[model samples]
Target chain A: MRTRWIFGTILMLTLVMGCAKKKIETYPAGVSSNQQIGAQTKPYVTNHQEEQTLSSVQEQQGQTVEEQNLQEEKLKQAQQEKEDIRKIIAKRIFFDFDSYELKPEARKILQQKAEILKKHPEIKIVIEGHCDERGTEEYNLALGEKRARAAYEFLILLGVDANRMQIVSYGEEDPLDPRHCEAAWAKNRRDEFKIISSK
Target chain B: MKKFLLFSLIIGLFGVDFGWAKPLRVTIYGPAESKIYVFVAEPINLDGKKNSIMVQEVVQCIKVKLKLFPFFKQLSPKDILEQGKINDVARIDYKKFFLSRADIVITIGERYLPDTGKTRIELRTFDVFKQKMILGKAFDLTNQRQVVLMVRKYLGDLLQLIMGNKAFFVNPIVFVHKGIKKSSIYQIFADGFGLKKLADIQGIVLSPSWSFDGEKIVFSVIQHEQHKLGILDLKTGNMQFKKLPGNSCISPVFTPWGDIAVSLDFSGSPDIYLLDKQLKIEKALVKHWGIDISPCFDQSGSKMVFTSSRLGNPHIFLFNLHNNQVERITYEGNYNTSAVISPDGRLIVFSRLTPEGHRIFVHDLKTGQEKQITFGPGNDEEPFVSSDGYFVVFTSNRSGKYKLYYTTINGDGPYLIPTNNISTFSPSWSWVEEKYF
Candidate 1:
């Protein structure tokens, strides 16, 4: 009879401990068991069930706030990455006078742009072709298109989708440098990348 | 014997043999020796009123108009007055002008008619050598603004009577006045008066060409980094734009059939295409893997002259519409562009880049001869030949800033066209009827 009583007491103790642990787990990770107990012992006259419901609601509210913060951090990180992609693609590649042939440096820059464009499929860009004032307005327009097209084709070869790019020719109209000098012309003869759309 | 002695004395005073057998018909391309000496007499106030400013303005207008014809040498009014005083003649003395070697004498008489409250302007042109009046016209002016029109009309009649060609006086020149942020199209008289701002476009306006009827204009507008084709209905003063298939819209010109021929790259290359009146693509006119733009058609529409890079460098090519044969007309220059063909399709004027700068050159299609017409310290480009094929107007930076300068087809007198300090370019000269102005 004594041995049986001891076994029965140990079994009761295990069952009670399991029930308390389950009750604590039901509350939020932020709501400590000590805080729950302190809330239950408040001097204000209140229903016990109502007090438990209020604490549970508070725990849920706290959990939602923490989830919102994590989501905001993720959104901020995405925006930063998008801005870095924009800066990289906005870089300009230059060309020679009256010629649309891409130089080695231009090719290198275009490769980097293509990689960014590939990684960011939602981005749509316009490749603007520009020319120096040395050529006539009409011919320079065509030449500028050729320059833009050169860079565009090179980007396509580097695995950037052709549909993601459009081309325009400014043709001695929009100059980066307005001075009437060789250096200014060299700077003006370039291919500029513009981000049209980014989702 | 008195008449013979008088003639001999007149010949002796002038020191040149005076031919009275034929009326002096100043040939359009006469040599410098055959230049007609024109004497514009001082305006005579019929009522003896002190309107010296009006008189001076009228005289200045007449002299400026006369200067357009390279074959006419204007004798200073002061010198002519001094010569007349020496001869002691109050009225116009044909003998004194004939002795002074003045081939043509223009007389102006202004009288204020109080009955009608208007000024009566009587203009008469006398053949000095023939000793007879050739032409006379009178205008009733209600205000001073009509003075320019009256003078232009009188000169037009006089020029037609002399050279049988008066297209230059009636034609208006359209050009772009580039500003700091926006550019506007302006229409001015060939004599550099009547500057009217046609349109104040928001962005850059380029390559404005007049239709054959002169009632409409087609040009390219670059706004917000997009090139669009703009059509201006001069009759209603309405503007319409078309976003073409490609990003390029350059050198929009009117074909003789009233269609638009412009450069577009919708076909993966910059090629010349024909668009209908509604700005829809009719067909591709000039297509190549290389660059082609600036297509200018002759009056008959039988031929077109354009700048193309099919042969590797930018050169002017002539495309025959009848045969559809593409022949490269320019062979010398590595960079030749902005070509315009004469109305008769005989001459092509273009700009060729040289070591110094861009200069204007004329290539005769028949003779295959290319002659440099403009020698510039700065770039002189965008040559527009008049419909009469006698005058070539272009834009030049020879005066530190680009201004409109006009010269004869033979490269005579690239006179500055005053634009009131604003830089101008892309001159398009067309003959609109007098009623439009």
Candidate 2:
């Protein structure tokens, strides 16, 4: 009887270990830049501000025009590297205003995202649906959810596993741009991907 | 209590306080932060019930206690003080306000102290452009807290009326937050204050609509691997669920007699259904070409506002139950969906896709004028008007996270729900309670 009890304990421990191992086997989907996309300055403003700061730094260095050009190129390259990190950190799929029906442009973006998921099958992702400032907060949230769901379904159709994907809607609480312009509004309506974990 | 006693004294002064040999004109200036000056009529009356002069004492207390409404100061005495004749309400001329820049204007009935314990505080709201009184409010206060509350509520209201409601206080907002990924449906307040988790569910829950009573919320939920319609009692925190046949249930609207009108797309394309209080399918409301979704019952449940894709693109359409006549309401936007009619049924707020992106817009059914409410980055969509029709709660990515935001109906600074935690979405705000006051 003691031997049998010991055997049962061993089986329970093995099952727990197996479950943990399975969860750990999945590769983290999407890049985790921890870039704090929100804490960063508005995208448009950040880009413009970086350009100005780069120019000032070049002047301070007292480099030749060609040297300044080289330095500027390096700055651009560095900024691009950071942005590349942001992109890998998460891929944002854009959408048309109000319509959750994936636009042709959105399909193209999703195709690229699909490729990433295919390359990283062990990764799990959460698709965030977003909207611009427009309607009621509640409605925008639902629409955003729909938008994210559209992207999720598209990916699933593209062979992405449903278990590996989850969706959440931010509605319009977070805006990539804070301005009240058409350009800003367009940027706000989007579906973005976040990698929850890696195998 | 203190505020009330002080306010009463201010009222008393209105009669004898401003009245002087020469009516000294006074005007409140600057923002709420600035000290409001009285521009008194010199030396002042040294004797006028000094002990019982609660108004002066109250003014002194306000000068000391409140940071916003400061004690009135005396402006320089002049028969015709210039300063550009005080054109705007923000900038008023003492000369124009009072013919002479003297201290006070003694006008009968301008200040009145009733014999009863209750004090009637009369407020005259003036139009800056016309320099004429456009509205008036009378606050009957018997105590201090009531005085403070009255002042706060009415002062803000008056400010809104003066500078327009758009520039005023934070409008009420509503949104739903899920637990982790899928948990319960919670409502977000406008000022980002009250958060009440309305439902507990294991499956997916979707759009919620306010009943005419505003006490119950009707929302679509998925449970037991089946789609169901649910009504949540705000008071009791009890939820009643009625199962539908298919796996897809979208918008749910509550009608009279506890009946619900819902748009169920489970049967291929979207269609409308009327369900009794028990969640039993009553009948099909509409089964036509294309998809029909986002149905909201009007005040009387006589007509419903819904989105239909019959015309190729989705647009808001009204369906009359009695006549079975469907008419399109929006023509400008290519995609206009998720329309919620106002409590009075005179206005509708909806989400429209424009060149600028998805935006919340309010359409005046009478005037045929559509006013855009959201601006900036992220698409603001699926706008639901509050029961009172004062504000809208919508979703935006202004926080770089899919969270909820509240905006005044006019769309000023969208009130971002302050949360850095998990994202919130698919907010269906309950109607404002009857006791919004």
Candidate 3:
């Protein structure tokens, strides 16, 4: 009679501990065991049940190792795509008000652009000249023209062919930044290069 | 057969006629009689020795000089004085003048004084039905060569007074011809004829604006490594430059009197500054460190329309001098620039960049309505309206080259000025002289 009672109590204790672990896992990753349930019950039960099923399937099939490795490779490929997009820094050049003369900073930016162009000669580029809102419509137009020409000249000096490059002046017509603040103006007073056709 | 013919003839005599069925005249006149009547009278020279050529000759000369002004229907000089005495300045004679359909009669009297050697040409306006002479203003001139000019001036003034608006004959346009690439300003008639170079500056000249009298042009000239704003006398070749503090001045427009409203970058970003007659900075119109360029004064000079980047976008803003308040005028486009306000302040012509391309747009101030002015394959921008508010001057690359083009205010096809492909832009119409007005 004593031996039978001990076995029964041991079985009950084992059932209680397993039930407690299962209940704790059902609560969620950050939940405490002392927390009250019912009103605080979570929807994490589905994940826990799915994990239990998955573990049982893994024990039966033992293919989870290769599957997890494939997933890791896909994640890495997606991250590489994101980093590549970020690496393409859009370089903007600027000129003096009403002038098309390229300053040293503009030249430095264009030098980087030139290397990109040289590396990818198959790409076609467009140089757009813009002005800060100043002067008359016609005057700004002429100013924009001179600015585009200045950029075109520099790119040609760096081996970009006349046929492969096109220059357009937005005058004060196209502003990248559209605020009435200094930040917007600083962005507007620029010459931008767009790769019209890239390999 | 004889009996049938007789019956048909009898029926035909009483038949209803359809020939009298014409368009019904909508008698909007009602019982209320028309009050204002316009009459064109014969011109008379009072101070004889005929200082002017005959009426036909004077009219012909004006039509030749300004092909845009409509041709005048002339009457004999002898009939004008007689008509003035009998039908115009005298009693009502309602039955006679009303039968002749004359409610207001115009009498042009040209007088030449031998002692003063000045032609006292008087334009006598009469309210025939009221039996009142409204105006009898006289102009002084030296010779017959001045007759066509005098007639143009007097007729324009009379038309404005009678119409209570700017008469079409007076507004002239002035612009800089940069395609010819010379530093020269040219004046053209409204119809694009009578192209005359008003001033020949030795350096780069742009932004030609008319003075209050329309006889002077204040423009920006980059000469000797210095930017100068000078008032060029239209009739004479005399010019006086306003000394600017820096070489960064680009556009220079005139306010009333000799004061100037110019864009100066001395404080970093280009802002609108009021320079007195002495070229001293009076005050700043905008406080933003960003651009506040292209300041055009309203007809009243109490407000200005300029482009400001203060709202984080480059848009046209109106700065009221009285309130010192700035209001954004455009909201439809990401980029709106190069806006020129109409003389009446009822409309503004600006450039708006959309997905298709940059296009010239006219925004009506009253309705906040915007309409595209250019629809071409390439970009079109830098719109400047004519003095009479009938046409505009702009730059377009639709021809595969950037060139100066003009179109009617209604956005008709552009007329190419003779300037070549020097990438011309920023065209300003000069004020029409009193002769045209």
Among the numbered candidates, top lDDT falls to 1
DockQ of candidate 2 compared with the true complex: 0.05
Give DockQ per model, in order.
0.51, 0.05, 0.03
lDDT score at residue A106, model 1, on the 0-100 scale: 89
Residue-wise lDDT of candidate 1 within B1-437, one digit each (tens)?
Answer: 11111101121122222243235655433333257888887677777776546657888898978887777898875656364422111245777777778888877777787887777776766777766666666677776667777787778766666655676777888999877668898988778777889998888888999988888888998888788999888889999988998878989999888999999988788899999977899999999999999999999999999999898899999999999999989889699999999988999999999999999999888778788888987999999998877789999988889899988767888888888878887899985553455
TM-score for chain B considered on its own, for each of the candidates: 0.88, 0.63, 0.61
Please list the C-alpha lDDT of all candidates, in the order they appear.
Answer: 0.82, 0.60, 0.62
**Position A98, candidate 2: lDDT:** 64
Positional deviation of residue B152's Cα in model 3 after best superposition, in angstroms: 7.4
TM-score of chain B of 3: 0.61
lDDT of 2 at B374: 86
Query: In model 3, which runs have C-alpha deviations exceeding 4 angstroms?
Result: A1-199, B1-168, B179-181, B224-226, B354-358, B376-379, B386-390, B395-409, B412-425, B432-437
Residue-by-residue lDDT tens digits, candidate 2, B257-284: 5678776644545578887767878898
TM-score: model 3, chain A: 0.55
TM-score of each: 0.83, 0.49, 0.48
* DockQ-sorted candidate list, best first: 1, 2, 3
